[model samples]
Target: MTGKQHLTGKVEALEGTKILCVGDVMLDRYVYGDVERISPEAPIPVLRVKDERSMLGGAGNVARNLAALGAHVAFASVVGADEVGEEIERMLGNVPHLQASLVVEPLRRSTVKTRFVAMGQQVLRADHETSAALTSAAQTEFIDRVRGLVPDVQVVVLSDYGKGVLTPEVCRAIIDVARAAGVPVVVDPKGRDYSLYRGASVVTPNRKELAEATGENASGDEAIVALARKLIGEAGIDAMIVTRSQEGMSVVMASGEVAHLPAEAREVFDVSGAGDTVISTLAASLAGGLSLVEAASLANTAAGIVVGKVGTAVVYLDELAAKLRENELSSIESKVATLQAAQDVAASWRARGLTVGFTNGCFDLLHPGHVALLAQSRALCDRLIVGLNSDASVSRLKGPTRPVQPDIARATVLASLASVDLVVIFEEDTPENLIRSLRPDVLIKGGDYTVETIVGADFVQSHGGKVAIIDLVPGFSTTKTVEKLSR
Candidate 1:
């Protein structure tokens, strides 16, 4: 199988894979606004507050990413006895398939990093945190909690942000317990001390962190691998995975095995929480029974996805699966076809006694609404054929500025969706011709359209086929999106 296919299968196997994540947890808050002028009181831009949001940060983010990948995560972390800490606990409680063990340290203060963003750019960042190591009593209790949870997990992840949660003692204790339990430990290391991570199965350090930790040149692939091996030998770890931003990732093992996987991200919108995504996916993949190399490869893919999104986002299983399918040439080419090909494919499905469904749209900027419509359409039949309006047709029907993406681009994207079995581009404003040609078993459309208003409803129903009107997801419209972008 191709690498994408292999990784896709590994992602599928991640369901119910138990993971124990122990480390620092914080709340990341973003304050978004518009900056129209300079502040009179200080040398800074004045941000007119508009909106704000928050999400789990640090190791809590790692656990969130693991949960998003369909893993059963046991998250253990320390939080201060404060309102922010309470909010963090409440957020963790809402994540599915996750069991949180948050130790409350009354004397310590919870960490909160707030960034002020204006016009899509961060202007300033303020932090409220305490970096002092946990009290001895609290550390002992934390380690004991982690140790008790290790035996049941298939993998252990130590997410260290240098936030004082993963102290030297805690790190060593958890690593030893995990090693004794035969559960591999994945460490997202912080600071220059590799000794704290001794006995780990793998340590993931970005280029900068690797250089700082080993005090070596991590500029090229050879230099990186050398530094990684040096650290592995020095730290008594089995292997090291170095994340080289745009250059990709390098896997160096003490067994003399090495592989440099290329970066998978197409666009870099935000690198926030990317490391969390990598380590979480790596641990989850390993727990799913993949080899270290296979796990790292999947982690690389997950990192690629998370960076393309805004904020400290987690990569969901469906998003990862869609990305993998989009990367496969055979999958894309087979799904996107001409009208004649779609007709033939529909006929073949019908010949095999399969019900074929048909749906049509400009699908300009495919959003959740479009995805929901297609998925619901697919569920009504064994096969789904999507009639895509060509760019020219879209411009003629909607306007010259319609279809933000070109015809081929739209068709390829539509075909990439697992719900869509075939995508056929049509030059006309309506799919009446295509539907008449294919004579699908079911005709599907969004609920906004009635049977009388639907282009092919009469023809399909007259030909003994049924029409389905699936509810549209509220508050999503490509036209509104385009207008907003224009504004």
Candidate 2:
């Protein structure tokens, strides 16, 4: 199979993939507001608080991402016996398909990072954390929990954030246990010493982390591979996957195999939990029986997707599937997506601060009027999604003889247009459900339909979106053209 096909198949097989994730868990909070003037007490800018949000951080993020990819994640971590730890436990419980084992350390403090932002820029960040290693009792209990869970999983991930969760002894214990069980261990390493993670299946380090760990120049592909090979040998690991921000990722093996994947070009937003996403995707792919190279490539694509979002976000399976299809298939073919995938694509666009536009029709026997409507709709937003009626729906709405083409054929024709970013085939007579799910920023239709007549106009307007009616092209009607041809 082609590489894309292989990766896509692996992604599809990710459902029910079992993985063990062990590392530090923290709470990430964001405080958003407006900065209108300087503070009266100091020269610093004042942030008028507007909104606040929180999510699981550190290894918890990895587990979250794994769950988002449909994996059955066994998450093992340590939390303090405090309110924040209790909150973390509550959040972990809410993550579907995840089994969390958290050891409560009475002497430790749960980590919490709060960032203050104004006008889309972060002004300050405050951290509340305890970096001390877990006490002996807590350590013993944690490792015992992880050991009990290792044999049941296909892969083990060690997410080390230097937050005292993955201590040297704990790392060695888990790695050895996993190795004994024939389950590969993937480590997101921290610190300069590679010896702590010896005998791991693979170690993933970013460009900076690789340089720091190896004490070598990892500036180019060749240098990175060299450093990775050296680290693999010294660290007693099978391979190393080095994540380069814009330069892409490099995978080097002790067996002298190497693959350098270029970065997927995407607008970079908050890169907070991108590493968590990469490791999560990697582990899930491995559990799904993908080769190391294929897993790295899939993880690379996933990293690209997560970085486009505004915060520490997990990449959904639909989003990854959509992006992979976009990468592997022809542009027109890629534009045809399932409703779930289209919804995810629309969400990704919105996360990148782009407005999404929606317009739908039978789109059979393509004509200038349809083209005009699509072009005008495209001009109204950053991305336009065309919801095409299925053959059954079209037959019901316009009679069996009305639609001259099948749904796929008509969708392909619409997708071939530059104005359409996505084409979703809806089985319903109208695109109301599709519109409601996608929740586009603007809803557009032909001038023949008024705002009151539009299917999703009220819903869109209720959500602070717009409704636009583009005038139809004169003398350009699909029914007239079909009649003329018949005559």
What overall lDDT goes with each candidate model?
0.88, 0.89
Q: How accurate locally is residue 120 in candidate 1, as Cα lDDT from 0 to 100?
A: 58
User: Each candidate's TM vs. the true structure?
Assistant: 0.70, 0.75
Top model number, TM-score? 2
Scanning candidate 1 in windows of ten residues, the lowest lDDT window is: 344-353
Give one digit per residue, the lDDT tens place, for model 1 in 236-342.
99999999999999999999999999999987867989999999989988888888899888889889877866678788776667677775556776677666445
Kindly report the root-mean-square deviation of model 1 from the true structure over all alpha carbons: 14.8
> How many clashes (backbone atoms < 3 Å, residues ≥3 apart in a chain or on different chains) does model 2 have?
0
Return the clash pairs for model 1, or none: none
The lDDT leader among the candidates is: 2
lDDT of 2 by residue, 1-487 (tens): 6556656656887889999999999999988667889988999998887556788999999999999999999999999999999999999999999999999999899999999876556789999999899899999999899999998999999999999989999999999999999999999999999999999998999999999987778899889988898888887999999999998899899999999898885688778899999999999998998899989999999999888766678888977887877755687888898885676577667655578999999988998888989999999999999999999998899886878999999999999999999999999988899999898889999867889999989999986789999898898877778889989
- Superposed Cα deviation of residue 188, candidate 2 (Å): 0.3
User: Candidate 2 clashing pairs?
Assistant: none
